[model samples]
Target: MNANVENQSPLLRNALEFAKANWWMFLLGGILYILFGILALARPASALLALAVVFACFLLVDGIFSAVRALGAKGAEGRWWVFFAGLVSILIGLYALFGPVNTVLLFVYVVAFQAILFGVSIFMFGVSIRKAVSGEWMLYLTGVLSVLFGLLLLWAPGIGGLSVSLMVGAWALVIGILRVVFAFRVRSLVRNT
Candidate 1:
């Protein structure tokens, strides 16, 4: 094991150690996202208000996890970006939870902006960690998908509740799967190390 550790690059070793400590955050977040996605998809017609609430809860928990992960990963590349993203998520989550978002259009705009910001941050983080992580492309893909989804929503804010629900559901499902896979990959790095 010492020999194996010695053979790995320092950055990779640090990343793996970080993953060992923080992988559960990813797993938990992914599971919640999956559940939310399933719920949204299962009843699109009745998912509008529920989606807002679920989105708020998801962002809050995910933000907390991301913030914790960033804090724990000292010296890791793009930790600050993760932290910033986490902060943004928290703020948005709080607003959505407490603010009076009475209209579907408002909700759509809020989700759209949040998704775009998150996607950009995740993409930058992936780029920063590419040298240390083997499957960084998953992050890139997730980020791209998020940005595209956000753009789609922004372009069609009047697409009605049903369409929004389906799109949000599909996006959440894909992102959840990606996060779950990435979490497992990070866990594998710990074993390899």
Candidate 2:
């Protein structure tokens, strides 16, 4: 056995076990990602209001799952941070869902801030448990893309509805695909167990 596997922290070990049992969850999540990614890409120039609603739904889903994963984790290291990140996501989702957005640029800065925080938290968690399983690095890459997406939003908040849609669409595509890959790898790991 690999020394690293034997020496895994309790948190990492438990997380791996959880992942093994929940491989199908990841697969379902992967399908959702592909669907959502395609949605964002399909209508790159969709109206700001429509995009905002879609994004809000996406954030809500992300937040709920994140919180569920964090809270349900057996020994997740820094689990509180994950909860915090989920909370931030929820709040942002709520804002995006209901907050006034007469223009495309309205929530850009706010969303950017939330995205940066979410990205940092995700990256940190990924690093914390990277050695626990295969394909975990993809989580880190997701964080990197997330952070970059946020920075892009921040860098050009006034880019308009179409551009924002495109960026969001592209980000969703890559990150969702990464999740799909990570999920399948975990599935295979579980199958062999």
Candidate 3:
């Protein structure tokens, strides 16, 4: 159900326009995520340090993109959550890059925290935009998967690098593909409106 352009709240309207404008980038991000996931799963036996670097780079780029989305969005409910999530992501990424905790447990906690925080934020955002976006369920599903993945990690924190890679990689692949699908929906919504 497309809202009349005149009927849309400025915030929602602005957000939709932003999504339409950046749909390509959003899709690209999803593709990149899928590739990264494939890489992780293919080499789950990679060293802890290597895995750490992969995760760190992922967090950094993801954080930057989240921040961009948050900044670009205006007047939407729960909007600040994205911004706050972005800040947390950047902090976690930087910590992963710099702080040498030298323990897999520490990495597990950080990674779990990042995923859970981001999932919650995106879930809220998706709910908030339900009336505006046809594919909000995709966002909700992505969030649910992320939260589940994080909880699984929290439940079993002592897993090996291969296990962690498989779990995270699989989740990323699913979420990324969902986002790519959702991006097309958004583009269609933009066109219909």
Candidate 4:
């Protein structure tokens, strides 16, 4: 058994080792989501629009890359999805870039929908983990909170641009902080192993 464990791929071993050694990263992610919620409450409109523009840019870039890859494909599977995605991305990007200022609500709706989905997923996870650690309650709380936040944004899709910007900024800041912390935890465990 010991030899068999030792023979496992380093990547798999590393992942397990990291998870065992650092659960704090997951905790930080929860905290980050909470912080984002707070920010979303403060300035939803601006935050959402900025987020949308950024997403649009990403989509454009991805589309260009996908189009190129698809064109160069020798026999790769799912080349059509990639090509289609690329086209969609470019079109979305162009709309975001040149669309009227009044179109900001479109992005807000997207963000809200995402938040609701995340919330539902988290809530489900919390319910599933109700019998696990005593602290699974936190997951449930975070999930509920995420859902509420998303719903609120959806409720008033016409929220001002500044508000949306602030919401997005807060979300980015919190998520970025959490990701950095999580990465550190993973790094530390891998180093120790």
Predictions: Cα RMSD each: 2.6, 2.4, 1.8, 9.4
Best by lDDT: 1
lDDT, candidate 1, at 137: 95
- Position 42, candidate 2: lDDT: 88
In order, the Cα lDDT scores of the candidates are 0.83, 0.72, 0.79, 0.53
Task: Locate the minimum summed-lDDT window of 10 residues in model 4.
Answer: 125-134
Q: What tens digits encode model 3's per-residue C-alpha lDDT throughout 42-151?
A: 88876465777777878888888878887877765676888788888888888999888577888888878887997898798787777777768888988888888888
TM-score of each: 0.91, 0.87, 0.91, 0.46
Off by over 4 Å in 2: 1-4
Q: Write the per-residue lDDT of candidate 2 for residues 12-54, one digit (tens) a residue.
A: 7766776667666556655666776677678777545676777
Error of 1 at 141 (Å): 0.3
**Structural RMSD, model 4:** 9.4
- Backbone clashes counted, model 4: 15
In lDDT terms, how accurate is model 3? 0.79
Question: Can you write out model 1's per-residue Cα lDDT over 43-62, one digit (the tens) per residue?
Answer: 99987998898899889988
lDDT of 3 at 19: 71
Cα lDDT tens digits, model 4, 93-186, are 6776677534667877655655565456445534532332234455455557657767888888777767766665555455445434544544
Give the better candidate number (1 or 2) by lDDT: 1
Clashes of 2: 0
